[model samples]
Target: MSISSAAPPKPTQVLPYATKDLHEVYTLGTKLGQGQFATTYLCTHNTTGETYACKSIPKNKLLFKEDYDCVWREIRIMQHLSELPKIVKFHDAYEDSFFVHLVMELCEGGELFDRIVQKGYYSEQEAVKLVKNIVEAVQDCHSLGVMHRDLKPENLVFDTVEDDADLKIVDFGLSVFYKPGEIFSDVVGSPYYVAPEVLNKHYGPEADLWSVGVISYIILSGVPPFWADTEKGIFAQISHGILDFQSEPWPVISDSAKDLIRKMLDRNPGKRFTAHQVLSHPWIVDDNIAPNKPLGV
Candidate 1:
């Protein structure tokens, strides 16, 4: 008897949500940005000549079922939250044999920190406004049963270069849908912004507030509260959850702002301030408290 080789397994579809081919609708242009699994490009509509940002995720990059699921979840989450003014609007999704493309609103103003640096002036009032927008977006996400697992200054982008341009939350790659009281075990999120509960491998939506607190701290002091040379050292510092208020800018920072940060950065998730509470806090609600003095480092 002759031995016969078995047939190769069929490849699974990477995007069940995409029905059309991306090339047929939009012409891909210059590259905008690149991430681990996707490369964002400037794309123009073939028919209307309108411009948009396209995030093209290669199928080959998705080596596992979980990777495909993550991309799917990201698409769905963006679609679900597109109506919110603070979120980057999702236009459509498309797929071919090799790649999945997500078309979204083009934000030309760039990252939050870059815009701040370009302006040449930073103040508590400006930081308060930025935090208010962030917290409000987080509140909306939580209310919609979505948890933005990753929240940081780099993910915040402006729609235009205008001084009054709208700041939008651009990346939702790590976002997930959650039910009340749901707990997640994944240790996900950027260093210096990850919550203590997250490092413990047990956390919820409140972890987002911790990230906002870290961003707010950086905005105020021009430095992260927890800083180290390596990722491991940063994680260790974050796990300790010790905030430096005695540093250069902290003494000059407002008391109410510090209070809010303390509450948001609480090691225990239960004690952390809720999105609503952060929005309702005196510093956020009272404009007089946040001074116009430049907080440049």
Candidate 2:
């Protein structure tokens, strides 16, 4: 007797957060952005007529169990921080055989980095305000037990095109829920913003503050503190942790600002300032300092 051999059928991937049919609720429109795993679109509610940004991830892209888990974790993290004013609000999620749709608040003002760059020259007062919002968001995330592994200018956006628009944090794809003192070994984060300890393959929430410091440095100086042509070189410089405050803008930059950056960017994660500490620092809290002088680009 001859027996035929065949492989067993794979289990179906299911997304718990996605229940409703996406097409039934919202009309997916123009493409906003595209990433490796998902494509974001301008979507409008069919009934309410409200507009939103919908990130649609195709099922085929989830080639592994870890990919699906990452998607689920992102949805959970967004929902966990939904109430935060600085975080992009997660409205709903939907799933079908083909895709998983995530509906979120629409940020029409483009990226925070773009807005700052367009302004050409901004004062320390302006930079302080922007950094304050970012640090406050970080503090909130930490307090809620979420670590945003990726924190960079591109991830920060303005809710509207208006001058007074609120800066909202977006893209929690790399974030994870962590307990106090829990160490993560994964080297996950943008090259320029990533902390040295992250490169060392061991880090905690303090890594976020290091990114914040890199952002602070960029906002004040219009350039990244660590610079190199290649990713490897960049990582090397970040590992070295030497900050350049001798550049054109740094000479005029306030001492208080530099002090805060020094504290936040400390090579030793233990010595790095917590989000709360950065928020409470005199440079961040006191309005009297952080001069209003325009930092020339």
141: Cα error in model 1, Å: 0.7
Error of 2 at 196 (Å): 0.8
Taking all chains together, each candidate's TM-score versus the true structure is 0.94, 0.94
Encode model 1's per-residue lDDT on 123-172: one tens digit a residue.
Answer: 89988888998898889899899988889988999999998888899889
The regions of model 1 sitting more than 4 angstroms off are: 1-11
The list of candidate 2 runs beyond 4 A from truth reads: 1-11
Task: Provide the clashing-pair count of each candidate structure.
Answer: 0, 0
lDDT of each: 0.89, 0.91
